[model samples]
Target: MRLVIARCSVDYAGRLSAHLPLATRLLMVKGDGSLLIHSDGGSYKPLNWMSPPCTLEVGVPDDDAREAGVDAVWTVTHKKTADRLTVSIHEVLHDSEHELGVDPGLQKDGVESHLQKLLAEQIERLGDGYRLVRREYMTAIGPVDILATDADGASVAVELKRRGDIDGVEQLTRYLELMNRDPLLAPVQGVFAAQEIKPQARTLAEDRGIRCVVLDYDDMRGVDSGVPTLF
Candidate 1:
């Protein structure tokens, strides 16, 4: 992991354009090659970022950039796309690198964790004859939220999120890709289950032949027990 604190201006060019004026911010270049720029304060969210599978180039600013007050520049280009992010540093306040090795990922808790537990208990919510095999099913990449079998006995991998976004779809896609390679789970299917799925995410999931399920947390919690059902 590489961390840098610098007074920099940022610009992104790809499907969209964004600019960040010169300011002191934390620059994170993750193990996966993703890069993030964060201001001094904000809940973990980066002011700007470039997703993984990108190349990074660092060098002194060119004549044009030098004249514009850019002391150094970092360019990140996505491997599979033309998306680019450039950070023009006016001055670096601090810089350090650490060999953190592979991260174990996050341990979710609170409402999200409880929600996953409840969903595991209510496997039938998936559909008739659906049975949960296990929660936090271990995989080489990471643990899947829930593993289940559909009526036809095919494996089903479910990814739970509070709000389903494009990234959630991507995550599920990766899990499904890995899971499907196993002979035992050769024909696995994927489900993006969340309280509310964004339209864009739903479209992406569907495009990949994955299903999207909208969860009603209140009902899942038995908050409206008076509303009886056939379940």
Candidate 2:
């Protein structure tokens, strides 16, 4: 990871064009050759970025840019798309790089898979007559956390998340889009199931016609143990 704090401006041109005025910001050049610009706010999201499968070229500023107080120019070009980003740096406040070892992927808390298993076994918690078709239902994009049938025998694509977010809804949307193309699974419905769902995520799910269901972990465990549901 290469981290740089500098007074810079950014402009992107290609599929779309965007501009960021000069300001002190963090510039992240990742090991994969992607780049991200972040302001102090916006949670973990970056203000601008170029995803990997891209290249970055650095050059000295031209006379016009130099006259504008720009010292360096970084141009990033995407490999699979006609996207380009240019960053102009006036001053480098800080710069450093670190070698982060190869990632083995994320370390789960085990809470997610556990929730999925309990939900699959207690499929009826979704509604009366709902039955599990399969866990990790396979599709071209990826697995749908759970594939099940509603009382009417309609296909239900359930995405299990520890905390449901808009991205999760978007993921299930893609799965449903692809699954519905199949003659066998056409017209699949989506259920955004999670232990807790943010209000914005819930709104987006509903707006997208996906049902949202909040699960009770303790209650589910009790049900799995042969204890009755508290209701």
Candidate 3:
């Protein structure tokens, strides 16, 4: 079990790193509310917005509704200039044969990694806003995750985590403090990503202008399926 967990982490890290040629290192903030960013670099803008146009596509089984297989299919696609990222929510669907009956931690890991990839792609597409400045950055506090750049060279701090917990928020706050201290990161904003966010945390984040998002995972195959599908 331990080996499985380690392998999963390695695979996920490699996959994310490969997707970010322009980025140096990445971090993963766990559900405990602690952040896990890449040590290679820093963020591009102080306030990074994941605001890219997204399209959702649905799939239908057969003409006969009751006689088919999975009820629906969902595809989430994001576009930023020339770069595009697409994902099939159904791909993560766990069927009876491969029942991944596990805790939220294991399940959320896949979803969060997928989100991180798409986020990077979005940043890349919007090259005008920021560029992959370096792999690693040295801050007064410590080393940061991937760092990006705007035309003027300002930065935003992006922190990733599997779960959004108190620890995560506190860690993010620390990152924000470092950013605020740095003259280079003037006008920075913090971004927090995770599988799910508590309601209280949401309110706290709004109070701080920290963007807190619930990584909505799409389900199409089973009873727990998300977004309704269209045949």
Model 1 lDDT per residue over 1-231, tens place: 999999999999999999999899999998889999998789899999999889999988889989988889999999888899999999888999999977798875435677789899998999999999999988999999999999999999999999999999999999999999999987999999998899999999999999999888888887874777898
Candidate 2: residue 16 lDDT (0-100): 88
For residues 1-231, write the lDDT of model 3, one tens digit per residue: 100001011111212322222222222223332222233235543111112354434455445632433344333333443222221121222222223445566354355456556555555433476666443355676644445665666676665565677666776678788778767576766666666777777677767777775544332112355456685
Q: Which prediction has more favorable lDDT, 1 or 2?
A: 2
Q: Per-residue lDDT of 51-163 in model 2, one digit per residue for the tens? A: 98999999999899999999999999999996999999999999999999999997765377999999999999999999999999989999999999999999999999999
Q: Sorted on TM-score, highest at the top, how do the candidates line up?
A: 2, 1, 3
Q: Which candidate comes out best when scored by lDDT? A: 2
Model 2, residue pairs in steric clash? none
TM-score to true structure, per model: 0.51, 0.56, 0.40
Best by TM-score: 2
Cα RMSD (Å) between model 2 and the true structure? 7.9
Cα lDDT of model 1 overall? 0.92
Stretches of candidate 2 above 4 Å error?
A: 107-112, 116-215, 220-231
Q: Scored by Cα lDDT, where does model 2 land?
A: 0.94
* Whole-model Cα lDDT of every candidate shown, in order: 0.92, 0.94, 0.46
Q: Candidate 1, residue 217: CA error in Å?
A: 0.7
